[model samples]
Target: MAEAARLLAQLIAIPSPSGAEGEILAFLEGWLRARGFPVAAFPVPGHPWPNLVVNPQPRPRLLIDVHVDTVPPQGGAGPVGPVERDGMLYGLGSADAKGGLVAVLLAVEALGAGQLADSPITLALTVDEENRGRGAEALARGCRPEMVVAVEPTGLTIGVAEAGTLELALEVRGRAAHGSVVEGGRNAIREALGLLRDLEALPVMRAEHPRIGQGAVTPLFIQGGERALVIPERCLLHLDLRWLPGIPRDRFLQEIAGVLARYPVAWEIVDLSAPFETPEEAPLVQAMARALETVGLPAIQSGMPSWTDAEPFARFGAQAVVFGPGDLSLAHTPAEHIALAEILQAARVFQHLLEAFARP
Candidate 1:
């Protein structure tokens, strides 16, 4: 537990926000290598950032996914320095994932060579999960593990499902005309407002999942005017849509197209990530439930409120679940901190899981 906390503090002290994970990746590579673990660094194609895979033995039964990058520090603070007080560890990335990463590292270390020889485990400490998730995407493209446990701040519960993300841009076009003669000109901004209202009435927005509840549609950005004196001829609306697991991408796209067909606006999908879900009866999920019970914790199951790297792995035929310590609400906040006790407890749970899954 002390060692895990120490490593967690070290990781939090180093700022590894989204695109700038080089330093932390270098530190982890050296640290893992020095500890006698085989480390492989896969550079993210064109980017300087690299995804570090540790102890990637062939055809491993399980792969542990941990992302090193965190969201940029907000709330007027530049970067967080590690501080421990009242049995809590405070800093950026502390609750978000550094604590979970430390627990995974300690769990692997506890398994040792003898258990690992029997189990054959792989740990993928990837980069850019907070932004694009390109690191996990790359790893999934090359390797197919039997099962994956994506370590994220889940308050020590198991995430059986996660919502997918879709980003769309709606371009509303209108005829430009002088502000004095408004009768002849169609105002794109006004048209955009009407479209937005229609979107709110779409039945797809109410699509429900038992765990995560209804999906959401939110207008994130809108721009229409270039000058104050002229009627705007163009308007752009960016919409963020969250969908439930098992919803087909094409079906959702068709629904959006149906809505847009009623208007004279151009539309395009900017980004899409499929939703993920692992069956409760799967071997990995059953083993994790037992592990949590063995560690004196409830075998609770829930849905991840947001998208995670688990989606990519699940899409590529690997059964994946999200499990870790700390409250996700604390993540990316000025008061980001995790209970030291939860970190230790999570380590114990992970160790139990490793042993349970290793048994043939």
Candidate 2:
């Protein structure tokens, strides 16, 4: 537990914001190499940042997936080394995933040499999860794992499903004219606002999953007009759409198209990730439940409202679930932190799960 805290602190000290994960990746690679763990590093195509696979055994029975990158710091605050206070470890990535990463490393280290050799467990430390999930996509294309445990800050609960993600860019065009000539041109920004409002009220927003709840559409960013003096010729709006498992991607797209057709706007999907769900009866899920029970934690099952690497792993034919310590609500916030007790408990549960899965 102490070693895990030390490792968590060291990791939190490094700044690995989305596109700048090179330094942290290098540090992780060196850490694995120093411990004699067989490590494979794959650079994201066209990017210098690398995703690392440790103990890359063929047809591994279990794969532990965790991202190394974090959302850029908020309020101009950067990665300050972890600080211990009120029984918690506070830092930029502490609760989000670094805590889970530490627990995984400790659990793997706890396994006996013979067990590690026979179990064929692999750890995928991915980059770009906060952005496009490129690293996970690359791993899914390159390796095959029978089952995957995607580590996230789930407050020690097991996440059986996760919401899908869709990003759309909407461009509304109108004739540009002098601002003083109100009747001569349409304001593209004004035209886009109505469409945005309709999109926000789409029926899909009411669609619900038992655990994950209803889907949502958010207008994340918008831009228009070259200058305040001129009417805008074009208005660009970015939409972030999150959906549940049973919702078909085409249906979502068609619905969006239907709304866009109501107005004069051109739109394109910038990115999309499918939702993923694993049966509660899956062997990996059951094992994780028992491990949690063994560690004196409740075997709670729920859905992850946010998009995760689990989606890509599932698409690659691996049954995957999200599990780890810390609270999801605390992630990506200024007060981000993880309980020390949760970290210790999570390490124990992971160790137990690995040992049980390794048993013939």
Q: Which has the greatest lDDT?
A: 2
Error of 2 at 225 (Å): 4.0
Candidate 2 lDDT tens digits, 1-360: 577778898999999999999888888878876766767886677556878987676568899999999999888553455898777889999987999988888887788545666776888899998888888888887888889999999989999999988888989988889999979998899999998788778877678899898888888899999857998889999988887888888888788789899887888889888898899899988989999999788999999998888887799888899999999998998888998888889889999988987788
Give every collision pair in model 2: none
**What TM-scores do the predictions have?**
0.91, 0.92
Cand. 2 Cα-lDDT? 0.86
lDDT of each: 0.85, 0.86
Query: Could you tell me how far off, in angstroms, the CA of residue 73 lies in candidate 1 after the best superposition?
Result: 3.2
Q: Tens digits of per-residue lDDT for model 1 on 77-167?
A: 5348598888888899998899998888788778774566566678899889998888988888877888999999999999999988888
**Alpha carbon lDDT at 172, candidate 1:** 94
Q: What local lDDT does model 1 show for residue 207?
A: 81
